[model samples]
Target: MRKTKWFTFRNFFHRSSLTSSMKPRPVNAYSFVPFSPVAMLDPTILTIGGVVLGIAIIERILERWGVIDLVDQFSKVMRFILPVTFYGALFYFFATFMF
Candidate 1:
């Protein structure tokens, strides 16, 4: 009798030929350790964080300066553009790198 696709797939994961030693342990089996403060000071992360904080501060300053029209227009454009750009980049990355 021919096995179904599901049966074949299931059997692949549960093959008796695989020894217990070869099986990977569950994530919970490992103890968790918090990152040291020094290890967390990654330059790339700090640079990205600084850029975001700078943008926020600039936006606040623009708002305080009463450039409502310019700010609103820029915000509206960014609201639409950012998502499209983000999704386009994400799709491109997955299409090229993942598949």
Candidate 2:
């Protein structure tokens, strides 16, 4: 039996609403981990994450194609620490200033 477009959409949304309401039940051993913010809210973050992931991926592809290699094979632990701290501070600053 063929379903009407409206019935199909209604069924989809109804199923989504049911799923969204289900509590954070553990699906596996480590399933107690909190839900990611990106999963619970606006798709904007997901879209931005997709773009950032794409750029990072393309950068890798370009590096493979003989462009300047930005990533190091052996980076010091501090390499990640510094930029993350800087970005965290910058994000806080902007969040405070703008909001």
Instruction: Tally clashing residue pairs in candidate 1.
Output: 0
Q: Please, what are the lDDT tens digits per residue for candidate 2 over residues 1-83?
A: 95544447767756645335346876656656554544424454445556556656766776687655344431343367547
In angstroms, the error of model 1 at 35 is 3.3
Error of 1 at 12 (Å): 58
Stretches of candidate 1 exceeding 4 Å from the true structure: 1-34, 77-99
Model 2 scores a C-alpha lDDT of 0.53
Candidate No. with top TM-score: 1
Assess the local accuracy of residue 72 in candidate 2 as a C-alpha lDDT between 0 and 100.
48
- Off by more than 4 A, model 2: 1-41, 69-99
lDDT of 1 by residue, 1-99 (tens): 955444477787777754454557667554355434564355654555575566657777889999988778767866786567656655654454421
Please report the TM-score between candidate 1 and the true structure.
0.41
Stretch of 10 with least lDDT, candidate 1: 90-99
